[model samples]
Target chain A: MIEPFNVYAARLLPSQELFAQGHRACQGCGPALALRYLLKALGPETIVANATGCMEIISSSWPETAWGVPWIHVAFENAAAVASGVEAGSKALRRKGRIPDKKPTVVAIAGDGGTFDIGLQALSGALERGHDFIYLCYDNEAYMNTGIQRSSGTPFGAATTTSPAGSKSFGQKTWKKDLAAIGVAHHIPYVATASIAYPFDFVEKVKKAAAVEGPALIHVFAPCPTGWRTPSNLTVRLARLAVQTGMFPLYEVENGKYHMSVDLPFLKPLDDYLKPQGRYRHLTKDVIAVLKKGIDQRYNEILEKCEANHE
Target chain B: MAKAAPQSLRKGIEVSISMAEAAMQANVDVVAAYPITPQTHIVEHLSELVADGRLDAEFVPVESEHSAMSACCGSSASGARTYTATSSQGLALMHEILYIASALRLPIVMAVANRALSGPISIWNDHGDIMAERDTGWIQVFVENGQEAYDMTFHAFRVAEDHGVLLPYMINFDGFILSHVIEPIVYWSQELVDQYIGLYEPMLRLDTKNPITMGPVGIPDIYLETRKAHDFVLRESKATIVKAWDEMEKLVGRRYRPIETYKTDGARILLLTMGGVSETAMTAVDALREAGLPVGLVRIRLWRPFPFEELYEAVKDCEVLGVVDRCLSTGGPGGPVASEIKGALYHKDKRPKVVEFIAGIGGRDVRVEDFQDMAKKTLSVADGAPLPPFELVGVRE
Candidate 1:
């Protein structure tokens, strides 16, 4: 059973909300909840380079902002690039005795559109430079802010506005881009995959990323209830189902070594994850088999990497 | 590092290398760049400086011109004195971020080694690149020679970072004409450079202690007003721009102006030009005067927040103002500068008839005789002879 909002607050997050109330985000926004947890772990001594997305639009509509820490929205892309500047600039200032405080942790926050596609070059550059920053990609599947257009991170067969199901075709013919694997290939100090369902796990990953000396990235599985056509309250539930069904594995890769943080040897059936979300409602039995096969292949790959790490 | 030579002591240095040294002297905090032709030498030397520990700056070698400008925006908003350099195609690639940099009020100083835009893909000198970015809301200035290129770079940082006029500035010089030329430059001491360009105090930056939001989305209710405010600031920055030039003059004894005139006093005909072409036209004007023609020269230095009053004052006394353009505006009445000259004088009670002549396009050499011929055509316009709105000088028929 899901905990009540009043009781969950004390357990899931701290009493002080760095991402304050009165934000324009829809109720039960998984990305907003993830943001709240990330901010709680990062604390107020963090400067965020926010890419333009749902979070940017909802938080900084105008004169009002929900962020308690210093934040900047550069463009739809280039959050990692902007965070690179922040990290480099602050380091120079701190070395020159200009910045008084222990250098503020720089973090870049963007939706999947910003991370996996349009912003890939900047992200790659920043990661290669090894700038001391944390980049968070809230994987909400599609371009939700611009009305649910399909992005490179949209899963195979997911029904997006641009990738709608038709009479003879399944939606979203392409698979999601493996952004985490790309980050790992950069040989960065830290890279992890987290889910909104597990707030403590995500928060711990955020804390570890902040403590790392070099660049780090967290690919967060933040579900979009509005875009996915699911009930608002099931956002967290869908995130949990995603990890449990082996569709989205919960893992961390530190210094090119993989560690399965939440390994479920006995994974639940894929329909348990797909049936709850309306995006997968159009899938026929044949399409479901294909999706399950793909998930099994990816899970096997992850299992091999984990075993290789142990060896 | 060695101490800089005094003003009397001249050092022959490559113009691009001098620009890199000028940025170093200004004590820049960050440099983000992607190299293109004619602009590569500048960033190449800057990379060497950072590598040698002569300059304590973060040199970010970005992947593309878009990322270059984007990173500069980031570092500038992060409270760092940021700089970048690019040429023709690179400038075109950075066009979008240019407006955003100005709108966000980041005081980033960039050097543009002006080169012609492509269809045929020429890597030569022209104003097509910077002219293409005319309305990007940056404080744009053109340089005539290596000395001006080095000096204006120092002035650009001061003008751009002024709290009253927090806007990005671009110092443009001809690609090979100035960037590749080695000239005698009086390098200013680091002390003098530091004194002139004081420590930057950003109006708003990323800080943990005092949280702030920058570059927020402006919706319909406030979009027009925000754009209005941005326009007003660019317009009102003229005073600060002049003030910055004035201080540079006092410090280095080198004067600059928006509209610089040569022998225009009591002149009946004026040949107006910009960038390195202005110096060439000045030589032609002197020869034409010796040949008993009342020909003068006017150089447009500031291209943005255009000095309408100063320009009118400079050319109003002349009978015909012949404008030389190195870039085409395409389907307009004339090239960009010539059109602007006509527009500036449109409301005046007594104004010179502006003659638009395009020349030296795509690095074609514009000889002194070319200027003489242009002057003759311009004088014909003053005599009420029929002429097209603009003419391409020395183009093959």
Candidate 2:
């Protein structure tokens, strides 16, 4: 069973929209919405270092920008490293009395490819160094900005342009890399997984990450209509279904302890989540069964962690 | 009114340590670097300075040279006086970000302990690293000795941070040749350095109160224009570069120039070089002069804007110019610097007969005799003796 949207918490969210509209994001872009909620949680006193990806391109076209707060986009693979510099620079300036003493939150934003693949070393270095910053990886599952190429974050049996579903092939060969678990392994103060469908919950996690004293990482599951071959308006529904089917779990790891943010007694059917997206249309019953088994095992492991944390 | 020489200390210090002390004197806000051979001592000493509270800055010991440059881009973008150091492979790793730093007009000062790039993997002194970055839009300068390297650190920061010239700067000194060798350096007091460099007041920065977007996507319509603007700023920055050097000379009484000539009066042959090799080349010119050969030496200090006028003025009267390059262009012209020199003098009416010599590669010692050999070969070529397109000096068959 899954809980409905909490009206009380939704009303408590900050009203200011830091991520302005009139941008070039695709219709119903889940990552755009996630960024909207993230900036709202972080508020105006934030500096964002974004990696080269869909969000960076869509929001930061030349001579125009949707960011109401200070933002910088450096390159494809060094957002965490750049943000570490920004945080350190800000701290140094404040300590040296160059800038005002107010502590502005520094945020690094990247795509799955930037976080899990090419940028892994920089991300690991930043987290290990414990820079007082937040790193948010918006996972749309593949390199959607580059026309849906396969990435390490692409799930098994899912068809992308590179991982086409065809005869003698089962689409992507490997399971999705558990980035949140990797973040937790860094022994950071905060690590969480979020979904765009749960706006209030996602905002809360961003707030918690902002309040943390050291490195915090939030792996956000964002659905891409263009990449997934789903209807433009079904981005939010797919994000919710992703969570309900245990495809992505909404949870947080605080200082090595796990707790489920949206605790569900039982997951909905995987068919409900996989059927709407054309990327998984070629999955046979055998492949579906294999994916189901993997999902259940991972979900149970998280449950075990959450239960162990209670003790 | 001339200011009295500020209280100073003369000490024999390693070039790398002196350079680090110069950065501390400049009061850099951030130092992000990775440890690479021949460049390690500079960053290690910087980290020691930060750890010991001698330098009040953020010392980021990044994992790789790529991240080191990337973090420098960030700190510099945030309006901090940023410094970093690297060599051969590390500079190669930073090749991608080097362009971005200049394109975004971030005034980052980087010290490159010049070392040879690898196939057999060398950690010794050469110009291969910085030569590969010749077109990266950074204001590149070559230093001959420890004192020059230390003084140029302040000059680089001042010129790079000039509001009209917000481009990155590279101070290139030969690794191990200059970096590891200890030389007597006259250090400036903190007050003098503070007055010279001043505070780095950035023209633009990431600030919440004044929200701005940096590194925006430049589409086809505007990308060319942005690149043109960057190029224009780099060309125009020569004025600020000269002005800064002149001001430093007024205070320190140590003069510098884009191109410095030695014993060139009434000379028919000239040897051209950059970095520490110029010192050796000068000795060879003295020997040639004693032997009744009208030979002279010309050293390039500023490399980026190319200093075509200064170079032409220095060598137009000479009959033969032996251009000594420390790195090869490999299969095409045999030498990068010699090729550029030929190109710079191509249209000149009274240019010398240029001879290219690739020497001192991968830390191979280029002695005074080697330079003399290059001059004699150049003189032969000038006298219509046939020779190869270019010669690689001191190479075993």
Candidate 3:
């Protein structure tokens, strides 16, 4: 059983709000809370290059913005590339004494479609070039901003608008793309998997990412209550269930070494995670067994990597 | 006419190299570019300069042209004087971000080596690449040769970064015709260029001390207003462009006008062109004038604002006007240039009979003879003779 929540640990978090309130985010928006935590960790000395997604659309309407820090929203798929430019441009200006010498942390924020699919090439390129920036992907599983379309990040047996549950077919036919592994494959200095459910763990990982010199990527499992067909208040609970089950593992890879942040001795039942969301309402007993087998296998792989590194 | 500068300043250099050198002289803060065919030398030379410590700038060799332009927006928004170069397919790849760069009002300058769009994959010179980007709200200008290419690089930055006119600029020189060719260019000293263009003071930038949001989502209630604001600034940028040209002339002793004429004195017919072909048309004009057919030549240096007044003033007295286009409109009215010219002169009472002649497609040569033929055909069309809506000159059926 998980330890009782420590109310005292909440005092350790930063009090300043870098991401402003009174924005147009949906009720119980997981991505919005994740962004707030992210900005709190990075603090005021940060510049953001945001991609076109739910966070960008909600926070940056004309004449009013939710960002209290320097932020830019370029096109959909090139946030990493744009962040590369910002980092390089800032460095050049600082060296030339054109701007002040206070170096700001450069960050790129994108959704799952911008991260896992359309933006993969630019992300790969920025990573390969070793640009000095943090790439944060708020993964809501599907293109939630565009009315629940299926993305590569959408897991198997989940029904989106495009991947509807039908008579002859299961929902999504493909498994979730391993974005963390893809980030690791780039051999960046820091790569990690984060979830909005654990605010302290998420904030800690972001702080660790910001301390690194070279490229770092943090794939955030941001739950979308609107698209997930879960209770609005259960967004954080669903996120907790994602980690409590093996559906989403919380881990970090620092310089080729793996360390699981939250290593559960026994995973919760897959049904407890899947049965709450309408996206997975069409799953059968055999299909749930198949998903559970895959999740256990992947979780074991992570454990083995952590053990090997501990040796 | 301005007095010539000392010959010691003139150097024989490739047009692409001169453009890169111009960027270095302008003290660019960042350059993000991807390698494409005719535009490769500009970025390659820039990389060498950065590596050699001759230029103090960040050189980002982005993965694609889309990223190149995207990165340019980032750098420019960060208050860095940014520049990039690309060709036909690369420009097409960067088509989407080009509009964003303008709408967000980032002063990024780009050099486009104008080449044909690919079907059979010809890497030759044409206006097809720049034509496709006409409505992208960039301040577009065409250069005639290496010297103008070098001069306009500074002009592009100067006008683009103006406080009142914060827009992206594109300088188009033909792909192989100008980009690969060598010419005697008068290189400006670094100090002189600094004195001419001055430092870039961005009206707004991404700064943590004074944080601001850029490229926000415009809802329908305010989207039209945003578009109108952009259009207003672009239309008003003509004065800034002309003033920059005048200042360059005062410093470098080379004069430029929106519409440059060649021997249009008392001529009844005029051949209008843009880019490198204008020089050849000048020769055709001299020949036609000697033969007593009353022909002259006019070249458009400024393309984006359309130069409606200058063009009408240049060709209003002429009886027949042959508008030479290097690219076709495919199914639309003749060529893109001709269509715009027709639209500009549509309701005028004393306008010339606008005859569109499509030539030099995919870098097929538009020689002096070809221009001469176009002039005679335009004159005949003016004399109550039947003609096609637009003539595809020098194309063998």
Root-mean-square deviation of candidate 1: 2.3
lDDT for each residue of candidate 3 in B1-397, tens digit (9 for 90 to 100): 2233552288898999999999999999999999865565899999999999999999998999999999999999999999999999999999999999999999999999999999779798899989999999999999898999999999999999999999999999998889989899888877668877888999989999999999999999999999999999999999999998998888787899988999988877788899998888888888888898878888999998779999999989998788999899988888999888888898999998888899999989888999889988887877777765888888889
Per-residue lDDT, model 1, residue A27, is: 80
When 1 and 2 are scored with TM-score, the better candidate is 2
**What C-alpha lDDT, on a 0 to 100 scale, does residue B324 get in candidate 2?**
91
State the TM-score of candidate 3 restricted to chain B: 0.97
Off by over 4 Å in 3: A1-6, B1-8
Scored against the true structure, residue B114 in model 3 reaches a CA lDDT of: 93
TM-score of chain A, every prediction, order shown: 0.96, 0.97, 0.97
Candidate 1 lDDT, tens digit per residue, B1-58? 2234353357899999999999998888999998765465889999999999999999
Please, what are the lDDT tens digits per residue for candidate 2 over residues A224-304? 999999998899899999998999999999999999989887899999999999999999999999999999999999999
Over B152-237, each residue of candidate 2 has an lDDT whose tens digit, in order, gives 99999999999999999999999998989999999988877888899999999999999999999999999999989988998888
**Candidate 1's error at B166, in angstroms?**
1.0
Provide the clashing-pair count of each candidate structure. Answer: 0, 0, 0
